[model samples]
Target chain A: MSTSEGGDSPGEAGGGPDGTGDSGGLRTTLTRTRAATALTLRRRDSLSVVTGVTVIYLLGYLWAVGDLAPGFGGYGLVLAADPLGGLLRTTSGPLSFAPVALVRAGPLAYEASLNTLVGLGLALLVGLNLGLTYLTRKQPAACGLRSSTGVLAGVPALLSGTACCGPVVLVALGLQASGVILTAFQVLLPAAVLVLVGSLVAVGRQVRPEAMAAASGSGARGSDNRE
Target chain B: MPRLTRRRTLASLASLGAAALAGCTTDANTGGGGGTVPAADDRLPLPIEPPALRDAAVSGGPGKDGIPSIDEPSFVAPAEVDFLADGDPVFGVARDGVTKAYPQSILAQHEIVNDELAGDPVSVTYCPLTGTVLGFDRGATSFGVSGRLVNDNLIMYDRATETWWPQILATAVPGPWNAEPETRSLREFRLVWTTWERWRGQHPETRVLSRDTGSPRNYARDPYGDYNPREGYYAGGAPLFPPLREDDRYGPKRVVMGARAPEGAVAFLKDGLREAGLLSGQLGDVPVLAVHDPRYDTGYVYRNPDELAYESVDEGVEGPAGITYAPDRLPLDRIHTFDAMWFAWAGFYPETDVYE
Candidate 1:
């Protein structure tokens, strides 16, 4: 029943230089910390790349929808209003050209602020992925969470797509592009909210199960061995 | 990692500053009323020879008093008089040792004419602004009488009526008595007679008349019909016209004649014109004869209301000071319709013997 034979073998302990119990314990702790840090870093890096790519994709969708649709359709009011909506709009229909389209619509001031905010949101998503990836590194079954996180990250961009669709269209057709930037900001707001939620969940999981259990269990075992 | 470089930041700031400065500079003459200039060629054509008087003998000579004079000749029919479309002809009068003439033709066009003649202060006055003519006699103690021409059709007051007339045209208004008359007094009428007198005194080359020996009257009754001499006749009534408001009276009175003054009167007019931007740099050095007398009441005649009112003082008063009449009464402010007055001195040229 004990993990010492197979599940908790010497190799599983991530072997240390000295064979003493204290040394093994210390080595195990160090290896776990390093593994967690590496996993977090890798997840963060991937998330950053994914978020950045998503922004670029959203921009394309905004551009295309704005160019093709008439009136306020290009502004994508629905996408801008909700995070999921923005992501959906970006991924859906022939309106995939929003991002690139917004750039051509006007000068830098119109889009720079909203784009910066979006870029920040995407960065946060990368951070979240790093945390989640670090937590599940030892368990392959939990690896599926990465794809779900990615999908969730896309929701904001989709919502931004819908909300900004109308103004984006106007900007594409030689109208004021500032409207699109403004609408995009509204759409991306929900993404910020979601990122906050993800951060809280990650912190709770880290402290509640892993850190508390390890601290109490180690304390009791030490007393028993001494007795 | 390296910090951002200062060189790039400075270059960006400089470009922005340059762009802002460029937006402020604009052309001055790009808009509104200043763009258009009036055409100078809008004057009537001049006539060659003015018409002659039918009864030349009676109206031609000077009276027994030695001043060049015009008698009350019968009013000729409008057809008999060859009216020039633009101007009236010059008339002649021989009196005393001098013979002087007035060119109504030129006077009609200019309305106000100035000149010097025959060693005497004379002016052939007409107010083109109000279409009134009077003879100013400066020889009689600097106060003249109203001359009678064509059976009193043209009356110029002499020393007798100096105190009662308002010289400025704008000051004249038609009152209850002589309000609705067909004729109105010209504000600048004094200039015509004064110009004639100046010509006579400066240039004896035209000796039309010697100084008259008869004593000039200080006051006289109104001779024109329906114009009462007593009941508020002359300036004895309320000011025939209202005082000029401070805002409307832009500048001080200009002395275009007589002695030169370093300040006071001259400075007053100069300051006014300068503020208006109408001063032409330097003042003209012509010696203008400034007569600050109240005898000339330059007024207008209004047809609707029957009254003799003074011209408003809004425009500087000019003309023989004693005559009275009004033009029209405006509705909004209840102000009198005022006109311009021409006051000048006329004299005869002995060599040419005609009033030029």
Candidate 2:
């Protein structure tokens, strides 16, 4: 049962019943592979969770921004006369489904549009961070990622801050994401517990020699797992 | 799964309920209390006692009109007139002819006077609401300056004793056009006389005439009479045998009416008119006399002490709102008062109608 680095070679410790290393180093690599596999799965799961959560957070943030639009003096007339008007006009085609034109029509419309955009942006950022935490039990790692993402998201947030609540939502979403990811696991005690329990169960199943053997027996399990 | 713990389940339910309750409570209360508060009535300081008819004996033969006459009525004598010392007299007199016989003793005490005389632009005026009789000149300017200019429509006159009586312009003498026609010619000058008894109701000061009264005669004289040739002369501009100098004080000077009076004097005048049966129903659609004095033109009609109501007009070409008088289109039939102190005998012939 000789093992090869990178765990791709066959005939490692406790290899599959074929006697040839056709199963690769899966069995012998189970110990180290479990952690690595679990981490890879977690990262992928985090990406999906983050993307979904970010979308939801962005939606909420945009809604909040729109709700607070009128108070910020971002009426349609003001926006149209503003320097950003041209930029907004250019982007209007892409956001045609959104009520961007309606927003530019009147103060209330502008506020509503801004709020929606901000809410959607915030939801996306927050949702992504939450999804990431759900996928990976490493909250510290998620937090570091959130901080870096926040700096990137902050640029848009600042630009839109003066623009009817849109930027505010972005900033809020970024802040929420950073808060969720950077804070200690105990800080998000409930969510951290859920992620820890889920990851443990998943990794436990993967580390099992019998389960690994079964999983490799038909490559179908691996494919299914990947999907 | 084993049986769930009751305590843990109950705790979880409580926490969930608390969170829901927290979200529901967001609004708070904000504003002040409600109560009734009365306004304060501040009185101007003057040395004179309020005006009143003396209870003493009435002397001297009655004049041509049968009203008791006081000869050589001294208005403001050196010994009698004391602006600081005397309690002013506020008295009423009916205009019989060209001569206005003011009980000098009454005027001497009060020093200030408020009266309604037949003149163009019948005015209700205050002479010294500010305690100073600073003359205003309305000569070549827009609003012709003539007749009487008083401060706050309160008049004070001292007759014999130095004590002056403050006459308050309480109510306006209803003009001919007012709804109450019967009360039009009523001669009872509607004014508020602040008596000692009445004074004591609000103030706890002694009711006595001070001996230090004075007058601001040095102030510029109201120059309206200077522009008019007939004010100080005989009838129809016939210069009397003796050409009168501008300083010849013998003739009719622009007399000030309704200057300063005691506090609430205006209210008292209203009540007096009601008691005298002078005011009836509502004041009719009387055309307001709007005077535009450019010198002091703050774009509003200066409320005549005798005027019941007033509002300021704008200065520019727009003129003012509710101004029914147009100098170019002078309506003769309408008996209108000029914003200036002079009264316009609207329908009366300008040649025969004698006005001071």
Candidate 3:
């Protein structure tokens, strides 16, 4: 009955006795993920990895969607007549919300859009995955699993930020856009979130808590024990 | 005083062009449908019916007012512009003693700019997909991008009537907001498609559209592609959308000097005009001439009913009594022409007579 937020105990979070049942495995995955994420944030090296990747990915996302780019040198701010109303409006392509404000710093201008928040969410997921990957790699005892999903999943999230005319990649690759391709483009953002979450769960479930605690020179909580 | 002199000269030329093309006008009224947007007296030839064109309209990734029009466009002196490169394309317009240049880079982001030229309201529109920049008299109302495209051209809707006006067609087409509206063409003026260096060189005192377009967009980054070096979508072989009619005579992205009237539509290959300096073509049964302007690297189409043998000379074009006139100002009646990508012109005007 304990949802993902409060249920860090392996037995309660894992629904079935075997922990391999479909529902049980998902719960176990969630419990392990929370513990692993806490460890990631608590450790200096893993936290650094998360911070660096998130910032880089966010900036790259902004640049790809063209919300951030080099501009004529000037400093100014422009707010749309109706910022709140504009937030719900889409621009350029699907899921690409209209920018409500323009902020210009010398040599650079950025359009403030809801997509930035979307990108931030994706970036955090990607960064967490990478941080988990780092923890697994740095301490072999922590987990025997390794994954490149963090990097791979980040690609679609970046492409999901299509520009005003069409998909920026399509334009760059000189590929003709068809109905099927555009439809596929529309699902990219959601697809990325699903992939990142699945990858994170897959990565987290492998982290043996007792081994991770030993690796980090910390005490393992009885609730976090998976064995 | 010199600016005033040049403005008067441009006004005179515009008047002469309108008067000369008046022969193409008839009793046909592309009705304004009681709209504030001014309707042209002559009904331009539409490839398809108004309702059908409306049916063919497809969403270009935005909704009404999605690609916001610069309602209160601000401009700066050419010297104050640092965002534009020398070769960046700019749409230069001169009317009522005012000269202004709208950079393609900036307009690429915002398709429509509702601004004033010497107290007269006008909309400067650019379609990145079709590579067309058109200027229309807005009358008392302004225009906005409908975020819908027909034949890969920007569909502008008037604020007053909300009727769809495709940039290439310049004619009213029924839209979702106001179906069954009048089928009328707009009063269009020429927006010279020239490079920033060329436009600035010709009009030294010209006001350049500043990066201070109230809406915050990365003006330096063209979502469609680059124009100065011609890359990405601008240089692509295939159009983003299928054309209404397909003609393989020229590449889809090839730029052509296109002019249409009630009589018919005609196009001259821009490169061919540049090379030959002068080319003759036909709009339906009437004879027309395309004179290349070396100053701005643009072409002007004129109605030459007499088949006048005017040759391109160093001064401009030599005509009656061997006196030379500017390429933009020939003795013959001028047809309102603007540059368009070949596919757009052919798609919108399938019967167009092309001079390559």
Q: Report backbone clashes per prediction.
A: 185, 111, 0
Best by TM-score: 3
Error of model 3, residue B300, in angstroms: 1.1
lDDT of each: 0.26, 0.24, 0.78
**TM-score for all predictions?**
0.19, 0.19, 0.86
Please report the TM-score between candidate 3 and the true structure.
0.86
Residue-by-residue lDDT tens digits, candidate 1, B97-202:
4444444433332222222334544444543211234433333222221221221112222232222122221111122222322111222212222233344333
The residue-by-residue lDDT of candidate 3 on A1-227, one tens digit each, is 11122323333334433366887777767777787888777777788899999999889888878889887667988887788877878876767888889888988889898979988988898889888887777665445554555556666655654533354457666776666776677677788788888777777776654457555643334334223
DockQ versus reference, model 2: 0.00
RMSD of each: 38.0, 36.2, 7.6
Worst 10 residues of 1 chain A by lDDT: A101-110
lDDT of 2 by residue, B1-356 (tens): 11111111223223322333343322211111221111112122121111111211111111111111122122333243232212222222223331122222233223333222443111122222111121111111111111111221222211211121222211112221121211001011222222222322323322222211221111111111111122221112211111111212212122211112111010012122222211111111121222222221111112233334322233312223454432212222211111111111110111111111
Best by lDDT: 3
Predict model 1's lDDT versus the native: 0.26
Q: Per-residue lDDT for B72-158 in model 3, tens only? A: 888999888887889989999988889999999889888899999999888999999899998988887788899888998899998
Candidate 3 chain B weakest ten by summed lDDT: B1-10
Model 1 ranges off by over 4 Å? A1-39, A42-114, A130-138, A141-150, A161-166, A169-188, A199-227, B1-356
lDDT-sorted candidate list, best first: 3, 1, 2
